[model samples]
Target chain A: MREFDLLAHVYRSNVDLPADVAIPPGDDMGAIRLGGQTLLVTVDQLADGVHVDLATASLEQVARKAVTRNLSDVAAMAARPVGAVVAVSLPRDFGDTRATELFDSMRRTAAAFDCPLVGGDIAMWDHPLLISVTVFAEPGEVEPVLRSGAQPGDGIYVTGRLGGSNETLPDHYTHHLDFMPRITLARELAGDAATRPSSMIDLSDGLARDLKHLCDAGNLDADLTIADLPLSDGAHQAARRTNEPAWQHALGDGEDYELLFTAPRSPRIETADVPITRIGTMRPCAGATPAILLHLPDGATCKLADLPSLGWEHHA
Target chain B: MREFDLLAHVYRSNVDLPADVAIPPGDDMGAIRLGGQTLLVTVDQLADGVHVDLATASLEQVARKAVTRNLSDVAAMAARPVGAVVAVSLPRDFGDTRATELFDSMRRTAAAFDCPLVGGDIAMWDHPLLISVTVFAEPGEVEPVLRSGAQPGDGIYVTGRLGGSNETLPDHYTHHLDFMPRITLARELAGDAATRPSSMIDLSDGLARDLKHLCDAGNLDADLTIADLPLSDGAHQAARRTNEPAWQHALGDGEDYELLFTAPRSPRIETADVPITRIGTMRPCAGATPAILLHLPDGATCKLADLPSLGWEHHA
Candidate 1:
């Protein structure tokens, strides 16, 4: 339905945002200053049938996905976790057992991330369970990273492999349900002044779309090497089943829940817990060229939108 | 329905809340201290056919209710707002024009309250629009007032009048649609050292139900004087239209966005913007008695649950 893109357009076009917004809507989180500090906040929603298949996944699985996806945004901002509140609209027929499981899982997963489930509102719907979780964070001892902070010639990098999440690898306890957020790595990088990212964004809406956000917000163009794209094993599985390239899955499958950021140099991988891949580099925007260009293995260059068969909402 | 009460039960019974939760779930807003300040957060949801009838209400009206109702929770905490984020799920047939109007209204309403709309998520549902709004606040120069802070023998006071909000006064732009949050009054009281409330809560789920929340959370009982209740003009109008008593309307018709609080003494009324009324006094809980007792003009005493024809969900 293009809801996400349309909402982004509305936020960018709407001119009446209050002067106090420290970090605006283009990034992984929005921030405001108060109590002599910066409070970074973001919210994400998971709807039955849209984000998860209720018949397949348990409430515990769904709860982790909802909480972790939001924590991924906090990772993008490189902010410390304050806490979170979850609001749920359950089916009227949703019995107490399922409700208890849902809240229990939500509380445990949030506590695991050190963002306790602080407060929430509950409502009953006739059908379709909806969970909206908001996380509040503070920029701890460092400036929060912004998507607009990218500079020309910065190295574009990402944590972990991407693709086949919420898709080919979808299962009760697989990729989509259990991928860890990049918060620990982000905090490590952001805590040290010299190693902080220039710009960062969480790859939720596929590498093609989310990378374009960084480029658009920073007024820069990215040249991504498709051969260097970190395709997950699930990407290869999806590619094998569909007769599509694994790289395509890496490029276009959304809900990867990985961090895509730019820094002067990639953080040292020897001390890191996850693999960091350099897939692209940024430059000043080409006059009228597309926001992203793919450098293929055979030395061919193509606009990201020129690729066909993106699953959903991938067009510019 | 009993969604609000059920949620309170879930939060209370579900143990293992992380140790850092500064102000826990029983309060109007859950709080945690970080970055040298206490961050208070709460969320509320509005759904079609539940909180609002989309056919009768504009998306703009829904947006304000979605934002201001959450702000009312912030006021209940006696906390200064930092910012807010709104997440919405639109029906597939929901046109772009209406979405634009909704965002515009949400932005304006939030900014007007000094709590800017900082970030949000968007989704599309098959039918029935849903809105979830989260607000973050900070206790400015004072400890946040908790629901469990009511001292026995304290005076229970309320700001503005109550009744006929979601029911008999269900006009397009009256009562429920347009009640200002008592954030200014809360700020005035909480900001000053001497006038802050002993305990506070927003009168949302009618006076009887909400007063019981203070009693249950504070381990006290309330003796409410019905004759002293500040019933709104709409309460009288609704009472005249139906055969119900005006005091019953004030006690049972929910969605009253007024502030209900307990203080040692009443805040000065002449300089206050809204009418402040002392309707009750708190006392120690007598072993197994009900949480609230109502005093009639003729000196007959009855439990709040003893009132017949309460319309909806008003019970211990």
Candidate 2:
């Protein structure tokens, strides 16, 4: 079983939650009540071989990815970054130079996102570099958005173009390692009283998988029009290089770090700071066959299961 | 270089701290100002080979150690536990049964300690089990005790006996994995206006190393009497079996998870809920030899540097 599958099999929220736990596992970020205020917290990690190739990727990039990935979760919840604690298990041979580079990058990245490096633990072990970043943040002015809040008939929108984030690093492609979290956009949307997203999640494991998660959490279904998929220029270029369909990269290629949110109504297009697009609509679960329906650019319809899922696949 | 050496080389708190970060690293638990109140946070990890022998220890012990270790940090700060999140990196072959047992144990341990499990992330990698627990807590009614508050004339006291925590597990010999944190004792000491500790730290890396840490943080020295040490029966037994002195085991063995603190004056510890012992006294850094001095029963004294520095040695 893959990581997500393992989690699905084991984790169950609301079973016997303690009084302080406002939210539990299976969300973009968990919320715990603190002095009448809600704090959103999340922990994510980037392993050496599993998440990045240490040989090719700079220590800075690796550290940045570790911080940003958690920030992306914070963004999904539309929370304001407060502080972070990192835990690092390093290879035995890792010395001062590499450690300095990693911490510097981690400190710099956390600062850039307004999340300072408050505390951390580091230990040397006979294993690949494993960095676990725990981010603590204040909920949005109103409440932290959750993946399970999606309602039927909600408009599904995505910030920025998706797919092709898995491009080999140090190249010209949109490296997910350097991709920024859409925190500002999330805050603006979450703060707006009139039109905030009903539910939100960051696209880390690709559109096809993430969208399914949103639907499953809400016990809903989704219908996406292929023609409306926002294809990144990198996805297009890679499609040409690999002789693959652009749609495949746009839908399945993970590491987008983009926000895939659902709102009661289509959010008004305003600032150009970050590109936003409406790609689909949520529907009530009506069939046992598939929770997602795909509309082809050619006006043909098929279930999402018919498509070849790519990107970061958490196998079961 | 070891982990502590690397931390000493790299970590410099207050270098560029965010406005809200009240206490930084090197403390029992870092404090951040949340609203008008202070929130204490800390993260600690237990790796397979480094912290446990998975071959001998049950999954429950492994998970319990992960939670208790962080809880011990919280107890050291005398902070009220609010919640916790765990992140686990497991070997690829780790299956559903082991994962279930681990999470169940984690949930149970956290709940029992009143530090409920709010959230966590789990992943599979080509490595042994590594669990990181991040605990969030509320500062005690008073300011959280700090390691740097010790004074030269402070009385050094420790809760419970020390050493023999490293006895191979599965056999009952003061299992560090199941050791209870001294949260109530710390709260009592910290909340008491008459006899609060000047500085406090948990004995995780043995009394010798941890006492030296308390002295170094407070810019003082310590004089520990070997005769006054409270050696656990298990430690005495292990020492006899290994042909080692009980004092060595009590002073050098780590993972005791006992409270080692210093009070400005000898406090009247009335309640016998937990054993309390006075083993040493803080002193000025008058000698150039060592920050710690061991006073033998025969009236002879020696620097801590002359002793075997056993316990947990972190590699850099």
* Highest TM-score against the true fold, candidate: 2
- Candidate 1: list runs displaced more than 4 Å: A1-20, A167-173, A192-195, A314-316, B1-19, B167-173, B191-195, B314-316
Model 1, position B45: C-alpha lDDT score = 90
The DockQ leader among the candidates is 2
Model 2 stretches astray by more than 4 angstroms: A5-14, A140-142, A169-174, A288-290, A308-312, B8-14, B168-171, B287-290, B308-316
State TM-scores per candidate.
0.93, 0.95
> Tens digit of lDDT per residue, candidate 1, span B28-63?
888887766788888989888888787777777888
Pairs in steric clash, model 2? B1-B316, B2-B314, B2-B315, B2-B316, B3-B314, B3-B315
DockQ metric, candidate 2? 0.54
* DockQ of the candidate models in sequence: 0.53, 0.54
Residue A95's lDDT in candidate 1 = 87
TM-score of chain B taken alone, every candidate: 0.92, 0.93
